[model samples]
Target: MNNLGRNLALWVSIIVMLLLLVDVFQPGNTQHAAQQLAYSDFITDVDTGRVRSVVMQNQNVSGTLTDGTAFETFAPQDPSLVSRLTGKGVEVVAKPLDQEGSPLLRYFLNALPIILMVGIWLFMMRQMQGGGGRGAMGFGKSRAKMLTEKQGRVTFEDVAGIDEAKGELQEIVDFLKDPQKFTRLGGKIPKGVLLVGPPGTGKTLLARAIAGEANVPFFTISGSDFVEMFVGVGASRVRDMFEQGKKAAPCIIFIDEIDAVGRHRGAGLGGGNDEREQTLNQMLVEMDGFESNEGVILIAATNRPDVLDPALLRPGRFDRQVVVSNPDVGGREKILRVHMRKVPLASDVDPRIIARGTPGFSGADLANLVNEAALAAARLGKRTVSMREFEDAKDKVLMGAERRSLVMNEEEKKRTAYHEAGHAITAVLVPESEPIHKATIIPRGRALGMVMRLPEGDRLSMSKKNCIAHLVVAMGGRVAEEVVYGKDNICNGAMGDIQMATRVARSMVTEWGMSDKVGMIAYANDDQGGGGMFFGGAAKNFSEHTAMEIDSEIKRLIDEAYDQARNYLHDHVDELHRLAEALLEYETLSGEDIRQIMRGQPIERVEVDETTPVNRRSSVPQVSGPEIVQPGDKPENDKDEGGEVHPVPQPG
Candidate 1:
């Protein structure tokens, strides 16, 4: 029922109950007095001898004659006058009792029901408001949800994009399913498996899938949930959580964002007494305290493994650490297909193509892309999601949602068009760079324009030439602005691009053995000391003079690459102008359109200089300076270092 109708019904029921209670408790004598007052005048007119039966109006009064002289003059005592007859001629005698109780006692006894109803209402209100220590006392109860195998919906089939991680975790499921198999082989099962990766990589999802596959109970909670304002609450929760998990043995405890409570103690300004530290200490103790016989396994996920405590990561605690990273092309395709199952997709909508377009997308990103595509189709009142919708959805996901209402002046639009076109042309022409996916003059997120490129596949090792090409592509937009609109038109739009290029250049010189002067040495900093502090040894591969020479060489390389791009665009100015104009008109253009304008055909093959060896490619002939190094030979400084130079390994 509606609220008003329910309230009215409650009011009516209460009123009826009150009236019935009043009737049951009302004094009978008081009502009898009311009736006698209506017949007072009639009884006074009755003669003594003829009044054998006296009728006073509609009520009958019967009495036995106590004296015979009452025939001459008869006077009935007034019900209100009975108390005033105390000092009169006759003495009144007591009458025998006919009923058992007084009316006053019955009235109070019947009011008991109303008192009970009031007591119940007060109790319920106190509980709901968390008053009277009713609901408030339950605050320390565990928030971890216990999910049985029948209740779990996620299995191995539901998760994608991390096959290696899955394989590692699958062993844990096997151990949980059949512990004796490992014991017979003299193998001890790992107590805990830490899933470490960036956010949105499906770490928590994998844990759930493991529980579902093993058909075991799953207890899921966040790391922060164990902490509370009280000092000892966190420790208490950790104890209780483990105690519960032990009872439900052969279960998995999935803690997401474990970094919240598992950070290194005393690392923060907040001392060891901090609640989070207390919680972490308790967790360490609990994890270590358990015997190998206990089947309860702990699964924790975190994006920041570096910040975790060393004690917690020692062998018996977190025995295995699985890194779940962004999906590769094949993995991305699998993730996309898994997400696309719920979407009403057209026949032409290919998950492989979508996956190829997104190089760094996580599993969450793929799911969001599919959801966005479905939303786009629904907005247009379409039955199925098409390729165009998916493309738009991808743009929306990577960038921000479309801002059609974000109007810009004509000059700004032109600048954005040229900027995007510059990136596209440069990336397309550069041999070591990936192919351009899309270039848009439309404002997306904080960018005035954007250019997107998809890597051919995941790269584990990047060559020096490939690194330089990437830097050149990054600087293309600024170079285009300088070449076309002069240096005066350069803006802050290239800040991210500049930072990226600088990092790549630094990596080349220090780590990749790309520089001739700073040959076969690494000066890269490991920023895990505290708050990303850089700490490392210096590069002894070069002298002060050689350092200056290296700096000059890097600048000259960037300057030459910029000039090459500018000259190429200058020779094909008409094509550049056409592409820019098309971008301004359409707001977005594909790589094929830009390719057609440049070469009048699609790209056949991206050239790779195989004639030059990988180590010698950086020493190619240039405008000035002596050749620094030869192929398969260390520099003179290598002997100074007391050994032959070998290439430093690249960062993983």
Candidate 2:
């Protein structure tokens, strides 16, 4: 389409240039050769009867001589001169020069300026009205790209994952190919298919795949396209779009992000009758209205199905809602392989390993992962993307980039080194905690130091033991800081760790039904919950004593985890010092490195007193990287608009 647009502009420019050339570059070869005789010379020739068939207009005269040579001369405007020439036996005519010869070219030249000015005026008006550009359709029209059957060659084979979604849409292709096959069984094709999925799940890609399978016309538009400031413009465009779709029967119209337009009515306090609702109403009617079965299927995609208007999802409107979810383990491997096919990868690069690392990554996310790996390799001037670059890309995606330029004093470095070492040791010591991948004092995102962990595999439901173990691991930083440097000497670098640990303890007591004192009772507002009860959901119909019991249980759980971590670190004080010294020397340590160092010293479980003394320490803030508390946990790194985490913020 872009090529077609360029070609159209080129042709228009060529035509415009040709018109200007004809007007400005006409040759005057014959005019220069014609004799330019004065009025007296012309009269003399007329009196001698040598001039024949003379024509004159406004002092411009041309005549044929007796010698058969055509000559031109200037004559004073004299009405009687023509009669005198006729009396002298010279054939004469009194007419405008253009009328006596070719007048069409003169008329065209006169009209050209007016035409050009009108064309320019119209072009300026179009530009002002935002009607695409000059010679484009009106602004009120749909901006959908009309793709032919041949244009979209991205078939189901080109796409990967979302097997269920593909299966749901495959029937639409069969219906379009031969509607009789379904109608014979009274299956009358579905009027619309709403693709519901999370962002980056390849909803739009699947729509194109359907188009490719159908081998029919495809009209691709965004939901935002159906919104306009003018009240009726949106409805007009919706009508026009449906009309076009009906005309091109056996076609697929895919509207990406349909929730933008089809949001529930009366959602905003701004008023009921708004442009978007009216447009959505019209779209609803057009979908299941009269002549709905014109061999046209509407495919709409949105990550937010819960927010869409119920009317739009009714039985006849969007008859089917296909949930396009993130790919599973095998599915993710397949998706990675599909994306890796185009890029040159080293022999050591394994898609299965990458798929295993990325548990909840959507198809689009996996594609970006592959692309990022390739770009990383290219930036390093490598011929092929190796597993090393892929690993770096994955880390860069999950955690922010390493802030190598961040300078830290010896004391602060020592604190950060110990903080990360505490986390690494706790993770290895905790019974059900995930294995630590790497530990580093290298600043990443808002973190001063971090201990990264990779889950053994995907876990849907985390056991109570694992959740509590995570709580102990999260509190390890604060516990180690308090034991090594006194309690007051523990800076707020362990702030993220504290918050994660507290949340898990609170969840275990309030929602997970694991607390002995609050046994089998949920104090949370909603299921799987971490929300205040005041806003909405189930009423907290419990007594004040029950609430106090919940709070006490939460505090008791956190204190227990804290005590466990403190005891573990106190017992392995020498090993913890060794790990921290390693971090201080190398600025980083792998899981294997921590394991190797601890292998020399056997771990001894120890119990410690809860009361610890606080020693005065500087209040300088040190940011640290987030760690996954469990298999399905996400880090606290802030994501930018492009979904990538920004650079590690400067430590305060």
Candidate 3:
């Protein structure tokens, strides 16, 4: 198009130049030349009648002679006179002399160039506005990219970690490939399939694979592309998109993030006149208007299918909604392997280990893992990616890279080490708690230290006791600091821990029905309504007396758990100090190192003096009675009597 415009401008300029040259060189008047030569000879032959007659003959031939004028009937006798008369009698009309052409014709000719230029300008503008041929100016054409079999090379094998979703979509591919096989048995292919899951689960990749497998045209676009600033542009775009799909029959239209446009109508504050509602209405109409067995299929993907309108998920529209969730260990392994193929890996690098390390990674996460590993190896100037590099890469992906530049003073470092060691020791001591896999005092991301624990397995159900045990483990760090380093060392490190513990405790007391005072009274809403309030009620179902009792019970549970952690650490102070020192040296400690320390030394049993009063000897009541005698199985506190001691349960 640019070249065409340039060529047209050049041709117009050339035509104007040619017209100027013609006007400059061409003769304006030839008749005036003859009259000048004739007058010169006529003066020499003034007395000769022969000359007069010659002049008359010349005038008659030139149509300038009067009927009464004497003229030569035959040829002139005098040669010079004859020549002069022949030229004189022919009168040349006075020629209008001007260098330039006529004003009207000149203006028309000059303006012709400007007119032609303007015409070409308008043509270019029209081409640009109309998509060069596709449609009108500013028309909302769907920006969906079409991929044909020739350009699409992805297959089912190319995508990983979404097998179930792929399996559901595979039927669509089969229909496209062999429609007759199903049609002969009176089986009708579904009009649409909705890939529903969180982001980065390979929903779009599966769509491409289908396109490649079926060797058909694939039109891919986002749900937002259907919306426009104009009120009806979205609906117009939807109509145009379906029309194009119909032209390319046996094709797939993949709409990514369909919830953007398919959000439930009349749910928001905006009423029926909403622009998005109009677009969604048009989409629903188009979906229902299409025949089921027309060979054209619609495949849409959304992370938030919950927000989409129910009409879009009806039988005639999207009948099947496949969930593309985070991959399991096996799926992770496959996804890792698929990504690993692209990187130069060491012989010792095992993707299974990487897969096991990342439990909740999706296909996109695995791909990023591979890219990060490559980058790590590149930074190290290594030829092949090793297991250590992959591990570093995984850590970098999960939490950010270790910030060596995040400087800390000796006091801060020691505090962080003790805090992390406390969490690890508590996790190891508590039977219901998950095992601590790694504990590090190194500053990574915003955390001064972190203790990573591994669950026994993926848990879909959790008990009240389990929740309380987890909270105890979370609170152990601050509790340990208070018992050993005194309350002064406890900083903002426990904010997140306290928040998580409080939430768990609330869940146990109100929702899980674990509290004795508020048993089975679920104050939490099932839906966890979108608003900030957890539940709509201003007060609990129980009376004020019961509420006080519930509050007291909750505080007692938390205090008991904190005191238990403190006692455990106080008994093993030497080991705790040793672990903290080791952590300071290495910046990290494994679970095995922690277990070895606990096994090497035993805690000394504290003996009470008979001289001390029974009531003053213990703070916690024994047997839930007035007596203050220490429980038989309770670990004695080595600290002051002001310190609490958890009543250790008796073994069966």
Candidate 4:
């Protein structure tokens, strides 16, 4: 009704403006059209008896001439004008001064500017108010968007790989569906459920699934939406949001990235953000304060749960914190199948094999991988996505897209081949090292070449021997370069390899306590854990002597790996030459190709799909050698590590 009234007023004002414009611009009727005459001409005509009749109002005069022509003129102060006209046999009438023109039209003309100014001011005010409470003045309103049924519904079936999280949230669905079941036994549904995990682990997806299963209103918002630039706005928004939640009882409220507003109070060098702190305080009060919010379940998600305020995670607030970590082999296979349903796949496209190759992929990453494969098939104008397309997609995702356009000279190509051949041979011979999946002298991203190794399956832990094998594989490129081109010709291509080996060795001595000389103690600082950056800074817990011992152990570990790599390359010099030569000729070799070359058997490169070319050589030139990609055991460099690796049993 308010909108109707406003629109009606707007239309009426527009019509009125149109009428006024027409009144001002309308052409006069032919009979009433009068020629404007000068005062002197009018007087001359009156003196000559040419005037027929005159109507006078103040100093303005209009009349019809003897010839029946109408005319109007402004007369000067002539006191005898009317008497003279009567004496000259001219018919005369007088009009009052106030009757000079249409009174309403004159009054409207005087007030037009004022009226237009007022209208514009009112329009601006209405715009600022946003009519429906969504403008500058509506900052206090909550931004939570209610997800209606019209918006695509996502159920538990759509979500895969995080079954444990789904199971944990199932009770909430049950509570919303039949609250009396738990209430009859004097049990109240949990106040809130906190979904905590790394990013892209299906936390938000789980929340939506719960809402879909329960068949209730779902109000979704982000933590940053609650706090704004204005003071007291966040608190007001919190109150508004809860009021909305209360009205939509039996509904679920999902807040993504809640750490934005729920950080620990009074935590900063300068001081805590008063607005954010107040918002957090208001949220805490509403969750478990004097009044209860019945039938309203609040679900929040954050990857950084440690930074949240304790008040927000108490029993009455977010009573349960469900961890949604990355999926295992079975879960990954399920996730892949779920994503694969959207793409047409060939009979040989096995989800299990793809899952095994992708060790640390999240649900989002799996979906992306499937999409990339489908796109690759489309690029080739193929009817269906095949296993070969999936393999190329995986390589593209792990390493970058193949730079077949990057041309390389013969010498540089040979050097890159030998560098990668070093890694492939060391990984194949080392009993504890993982198997080399593929080796390519083709430039990818910033690296001239890369050797990719895949674990047999998911790796849950690493052993002492496995760490040593990783160090040796990391040093293999440098060792091969030194052996083939001599120490004097060794290039800066080993920078990445050296960094990887050093990090692994340092972790072994400092964090994993794998060093005998450094003793079985964790000398590394936990700077990233609990209260990160805000309160985690402190001096080294160990003394100078212990630090020295740790440094010495790290150096000793790397030096041993380097010597081991050199000796192994020296022993298998002939095999190294064979693999390098094959790489130079073929450009890229899969696990089977590498195995065949190492066993002194010739390989037949057969085309799986004639539509898409395989193992194309680079036509563009590159100036550098190959670099090795290492797998980091720590979370900091998890994604860069690409995939996981574990010890593979040696063949008898």
TM-score of each: 0.66, 0.72, 0.71, 0.78
Count of backbone collisions within predicted model 1: 0
Query: Each candidate: what lDDT?
Result: 0.67, 0.74, 0.66, 0.78
Q: Write the per-residue lDDT of candidate 1 for residues 416-474, one digit (tens) a residue.
A: 77766777777777887666666677666666777766555555566766666666676
The TM-score ranking, best first, is 4, 2, 3, 1
Those runs of model 4 whose alpha carbons end farther than 4 Å from true positions after fitting are 1-137, 269-272, 525-539, 609-652
lDDT of 2 by residue, 181-272 (tens): 98988788888999988898888889988888878889999988778566876788888888778778878889999988999999788854
What candidate 3 gets wrong by more than 4 Å, as runs, is: 1-140, 149-152, 268-274, 290-293, 525-554, 601-652
- Give per-residue CA lDDT, model 4, range 512-553, as digits (tens): 878888777877675556332322346466766777888899
Put down candidate 3 lDDT per residue, 242-302, tens digits, no spaces. 8778889888999988989999888888554487889999889888874433877899998
Q: Please give the TM-score that candidate 1 achieves against the real structure.
A: 0.66
Query: CA lDDT of 245 in candidate 4?
Result: 97
Candidate 1 stretches with Cα past 4 Å from truth are: 1-141, 149-152, 268-275, 290-293, 409-411, 482-503, 506-513, 517-554, 601-652
Question: How many clashes (backbone N, Cα, C below 3 Å) per candidate?
Answer: 0, 7, 2, 6
Per-residue error (Å), model 1, residue 351: 0.8
Q: What is the lDDT of candidate 1?
A: 0.67
Indicate the residue-level lDDT of 571 in model 4.
97
